[model samples]
Target: MSGRQTSFLAQALQQGAGALRSRQFDLAERIAGDILKSNRTDRNAVLILAHALVGQDRAGEAIAPLERIARRSDDGEVETLLGALLCKSGRAADGIAQLRRTIARRPPYLPSFQELAGQLSKAGQLGEAISVIESGLALVPESVDLKVDLGRLLHESNEFAKALEVLTIARDAAPGRPDVLIELGRVLILSGDYTAAADAFRHVLAQRPDDGSVRAYLATCLLEQGERDAGEAALRAVMRGGPHLLGRAAFVMAASSHGRFFFDMSEATKFLGGKST
Candidate 1:
């Protein structure tokens, strides 16, 4: 292509990218399609088109164009996205295979590992999912996201100690990350360290005070630790969060009644009887 053509392609790609960021999927799709018509092999145009299709909930349609890019180049990111799209389209086996191939290349692409691990987990291959995450951690030792996944998987597999250890490292690496803290809090709860779990949840609440789910978890930790007044107070606060939190609050109340400390039934009835707040 001439310099002018190259410049035009660049400008079009920029506009398409901006449209995608703004969630103008139809506009982005049009721009990407026009660019592809001029140069069928344009990688950015193909990616933009795929993203636009996905944004519009047409993930299956995005797969073929991504595969077209995959055939021309060994782009691991594209392969990862293709694999994920295939899974989203109900082709899990094919997607898993593609993701495995992408990871086997060891191309420093973190999403390949994450997507493969997630698929394996959904398929009930927890061991393989854990292995995939561990492999990714080996490749990217400093990746807090990988560590968080490892921690969560470990917790699911009943390896609470290891999960706590991994999440602690992740927390140290990224102290204020809500995801890391949430996973850590869960592991702590499993480990029967209610105090530590409460601390973790508290940190997250400090950052996201309006998060009803976290508030409920914090109430659980408080109740499990036998802090009745505080736990009840927290539960009431959760109830006040609105109708969305009612079920969780009730669940916490019921759970506390059978946990380390029994919640008084009368108090539960009294609390549930009132309007929220």
Candidate 2:
């Protein structure tokens, strides 16, 4: 291509990137495809195309384009995307290996570590996930993202005290972050500290009052504390708000009542009054 054609291609690639920034995935894909047709080796275009596919929920389609560029380029970031896409497509083992490779090859990309840990968590490898997150935290101690992941994995692994401690650190790091507060509330509930759990959930509700899930969680805390009236009211509020009942209302109750018993059961039964949902 002449200098003029190369210049045009660069300009077009920039436009494609702009489309991605604006979340115009279809247009970005088309422009990226146009650039690649003229120059198949255009790394930026391939990356943009892959991002566009991912934006459109086509992570499976994104794998090939990203892999193509990843093989030819030493860009650790692009390789991270390939690994993330692989994980999204259910290739957990491959994704984890590729992500580890990406993390090992170049600068410590925080996202790659987080994504790897999340994939490990989903695979029920909570120990591995905790290790990966702790590794990330060692690299960037103040990273709220890594801390949250660590806390969640600890909670999922049934280490409620450890989860609460980690999440408290996260909350202290970002005092007003709702997500950290929410995680704190969850762990508190698991540890049978319903009062503190309710406070945490209520703090979140103060910031986002209409969050039905949080309201439901508050209800759980109340019910678990033997405050049946307050818990019932919270559950009723959720039924009036939306369709969710797990965090919105029924999960804890069902657990306490046994079997499929929930809000639908008689109010005078066990968990509430004794009922089935």
Best by TM-score: 1
Off by over 4 Å in 2: 1-25, 39-44, 55-57, 244-248, 253-277
Best by lDDT: 1
Q: Please report, in order, the local distance difference test score of every candidate based on alpha carbons.
A: 0.87, 0.81
Cα lDDT, model 1, residue 253 = 70
Q: Summarize candidate 1's per-residue lDDT along 1-277 as a digit string, tens digits.
A: 7999889889999999999999999999999999988777788998899999999999999887889889998899899999999999999989999999999884578888999999999999999999999999898899999999999888889988899999999999999899999999988887888898899999999999988889889989988878877887887788777766666777787777433222564455357543533
Candidate 1 total steric clashes: 0
TM-score of each: 0.87, 0.79
Off by over 4 Å in 1: 1-8, 257-277
lDDT of 1: 0.87
